[model samples]
Target: MDQKTILVAFGGASPEHEVSVITSHQAIAALQESNYSITPLYLTKNGRWLTGETLLDLKNFEDLKKLEDSCTPCTFGQNEFGQPVLLEQKTGFFSKPKTTPIFAVIDGFHGSKGENGAFQGACEMFNIPCTGSGVMGSAIGMDKVMAKTICRANEIPVAESVDFFEPDWVDHQSTLITKIESLEYPVIVKPVHLGSSIGVEVVMNQESLIRAVEAAFKYDDHLLVETVITPLMEINCSVLGSSRAQRTSVCERPIGKEELLSFQDKYLNDAEAKGMASADREIPAKIPDELTKAIQETSVKVFKLLSCSGLARLDFLVNEETHQFYFNEINTIPGSFSFYLWKESGISFTDLLLELIDIAVEDQNQKARRIQSYDTNLLSQKAVKGIKGLKSKK
Candidate 1:
């Protein structure tokens, strides 16, 4: 059978770069056995795109710099027929670069420009099929403040939050602090655009809040401070498909050692580095059946609300005592694609990935069916002739 090349793109210029590598390798391992031809598009931490057979091995990731040196630098280019292809850059004087046609792009990236819609927009520009949300969904999902705002508008339960930018804090630090404190002490401060709990902190007083905010600013200029739910149980559910149809996996309650799950708690605990799969979580979350159902329903709701597609894991903050769950955030490109959660629903990691690819292909086919460009010549010669009569604002 003729094989379509599926490009697994990962490792971005983000704080979660290492986790992204692990996620990509896991995906590569699974997709290798599929009918498609798997190609690795490794994005270096410095924002360079490279690809090679060596990138398929997880062990090669131990020395990122050395690994990068062995790969061929590549970028998205169009074929003579205007189809997107992974074009390798010129290496040596006599080197003949090869182009690999990209049938679909598996978004293995975790954060920053990768998860925040920059990469998705690039795929859109090239008319490439990308697994995960489109530009709007990815952008909104990356912003905690925006996600919460949408939840709040939709009457979805969410913790009371006060969000501000660096300049806002600089201008009115005391006022912002006062507003945060009003939500009461023991509040959680988080970098608005970060994940893996990198710049998240729970503080009981003004001093700790100040320090947390200052530190979080390093990860993101925008910050969100919200009341911390005491006896909080973090429940996460993975959603599949787009607005046309949707499904949610069994709920999983993450077991974090600290006040909240940290980057170390999520990825570094395992000697093998299994990404989010190795992290401790109670599958089918031992919560009440009704609560599980509620979370499952909410997960799909949030997924549709944010315009997410392909796959996403929605995390909810549940009050252990009251069992009142609040929409926390959505991971558009969840680690390991949250295959572990789907596995509980009778879906294997490989099957989960295959389904995601199927969804992406269907979405692309539907997109192609739409009327893309109007035939009207808005920029005809007559329009260009009038440009000289217009005055400059300056």
Candidate 2:
């Protein structure tokens, strides 16, 4: 069998671009290089795409000008067989065109175009299998408000939230403020279309709410304000598989110094400070067994409810005083793919990647089974009639 070439796409037009680069590098290192051919596709912050041997090195990213010069610019297209093809610049004038089949797209995109459905839609347009959630799932996952609504409809427990679009906030600031004040103090303000806690802010009072909203508005037009669950303990659980068949990995408790997990605390903090290596998480969460079970069960429920595929990490906030657990968010394409949690469940990173690839292929096959085009062409029948005959109906 020919070795399948996988496009490991990383870096994106997101605040978490640098983080995506690190995650992609980790994935590339874990992949079984002997079994599959890897293609490093780098997406710049400006949205330009490039690919080359130089991208395989992490240091190349430090120097943007040198990195751009070393890599060949590329774009996505379809092949003759109707498969997704990657078009790369030819090295020499006499050389034949170089293209490769994008067997799978390993998405490391964090926000907007990456976490949202843009890349997923592109994959669907070309009928290619890509890792992570499908278009609808990706879009819903990126929007916290939408995810909460869907979860609520499915009887899943989520925090109460009020959403405000840009126009609504601009036109009815008073109305928006009234709605927000009703929620409670220390409400969490978030950019509706971001991930990895990029534009998340915890507002302690009306004054802080205004400042947080102003900061969050810089990132997205849509915003979400939800009552903060104080005395909170953060627990994250990773789910693997599709909606039809899925399993949950061991739960992890993120030990952060702050009341809420900040972007820096989640990603930048050393693991030793909180215990555990790589990202500071306690495997199987030190919480009561009942709480652990509840979190795991809820994780699976949310994954299936969202129609998430491959893998996703669901975050939860447990109020220490009340012992009430509330859904925070779901990361369809989680950073580091939440391998640490899965690792405790006896799944290695390499095995996890293989499993994700298998799930993607199965999803694509199922989609292929669906009937798309009819045997008879409606256009042909229309052409048989005269132009005047068609114009008569109009």
Q: Please report, in order, the local distance difference test score of every candidate based on alpha carbons.
A: 0.91, 0.84
Candidate 1 structure quality by residue, lDDT tens digits, 273-381 = 6999889889879999999999999889889999999999999999999999999999999988899999999998899899988898888889899999899876888
Best by lDDT: 1
**What is the C-alpha lDDT profile of model 2 across 220-289, one tens digit per residue?**
9999999888788888899999966999998888876777767777677763222123566677788888
Instruction: Give me candidate 1's TM-score against the actual structure.
Output: 0.97
For residue 205, what is the lDDT in candidate 2? 80
Which window of ten consecutive residues has the lowest lDDT sum in model 1?
Answer: 385-394
Q: Considering only N, C-alpha and C atoms within 3 Å, which residue pairs clash in candidate 1?
A: none
Give all TM-scores, in the order shown: 0.97, 0.93
After superposing candidate 2, which stretches have Cα over 4 Å from the reference?
32-34, 80-83, 92-94, 270-277, 381-394
